[model samples]
Target: MTDPGAYPNPGQHPSPHGQPPRNKRRVWPWLVIGVPVLLFGACGVAVVASVAGGNDTTVTTGPGDGDAADGGAADRGPDFPGKLDDDTAAPAGATITRDELAYTVSPLEAVDTVLGSYLCSTVTIDNVGTSQNDFNGYTDWSLQDTGGAIRDATFGPDRPMLNSGQIAPGGRATGSVCFDDRTGAAPGTYVVLFEDTFSLSTDRLAWITTL
Candidate 1:
């Protein structure tokens, strides 16, 4: 007969109700696998939330419709040409003479457009310099509203556009320089700026006026 002392008695590992202890090895493997699965699941959720949060804070520019409806009026850079500076600002109807060129701007006249109105100013440029001076209204002039939005010179319907060409000394060129103010968007004061290519001056001429 086997010695009862050599083999442990089943009563030593009995449950509270005296039943035999069940094998827990199978449950331990399942617990180990489940814990890692739960940890990975939590990590995936956190990563998705982080990605979603990043997308919510992105910034964009231009109109709500994503089109340049105002002729790119609101898309000015910090170094945009024809900005005012010291000794470069003038009032409306003033004849500013610099580098032998006399620039006179009259009060703006509102020319109606299909979408909005055009603020057209009669500009007279007198070439008093010894040499002929070249002028391009679309390329060398810009208009700025009180809100700091700048627009390039544009042509209006049934309006006389400014003539651009070489002006002989003692000669004058006069016409209308117009800016399209889409749907009265710019309804306040406006500034007419001229890039002085004659002097190559950084501080361009600015004539202040209102609508």
Candidate 2:
């Protein structure tokens, strides 16, 4: 005969209030614990790997091994030709003397249509001296327009006296000569002459004409 406390027969249903059989109970306890533990372990490994990699990195400093030298080398370069050195003392050259001052009407001259005036020709003075000298003198300047009429020329202050009254030996003074075109002078060659105030040299002359 079967014992009364024994499990129910395979064909019989369980009592309404009784618990289910042991093997039939849900077996998710290990899954619940192991899944979280595995995830935590993976996260810990990732953090540790990140920290270890960061510590292994190195930062290099200072100039690159192939870099060129500093700019100090260029600062010690060659000196100017006429400049004086600290230990060397030399006197300046002789005083500049003016021989002849002459100018020609440059081909680059232009006329202002709005102002109805001709731009004065560019006058170039040649230094016919053998040694360095200074220039100090004044001369009246004149300009000829397109017509045969002659007119006086005026200078702007910006083009102050050449060399401030001092011309280096063999150096020439050059400035613009501005004049009005109202003289009805035809576009042609113009003569420029100067009377030196210093030595009363009346023969100093130069010429230039319009193209």
Q: Pick the candidate with the highest lDDT.
A: 1
Model 1 Cα displacement at 156 (Å)? 1.8
lDDT of 1: 0.65
Against the true structure, candidate 2 reaches a TM-score of 0.37
lDDT of 1 by residue, 1-211 (tens): 6466753955554467967677655688889999999999999998777544411111112225232111123322123233533325545676666555667788777778675688888888888779997777676788887677777888777776776888998999888898887536455677888764443334456677766
Q: Clashing residue pairs in candidate 1, if any?
A: none
Poorly placed runs, candidate 1 (over 4 Å): 1-84, 114-116, 183-187, 197-199
Residue 139's C-alpha lDDT in candidate 1? Answer: 69
Candidate 2 lowest-lDDT run of ten: 87-96
CA-RMSD of model 2: 31.5
**Per-model CA lDDT versus the true structure:** 0.65, 0.40
**Per-model TM-score versus the true fold:** 0.55, 0.37
Alpha-carbon deviation at 88 in model 2, angstroms = 46
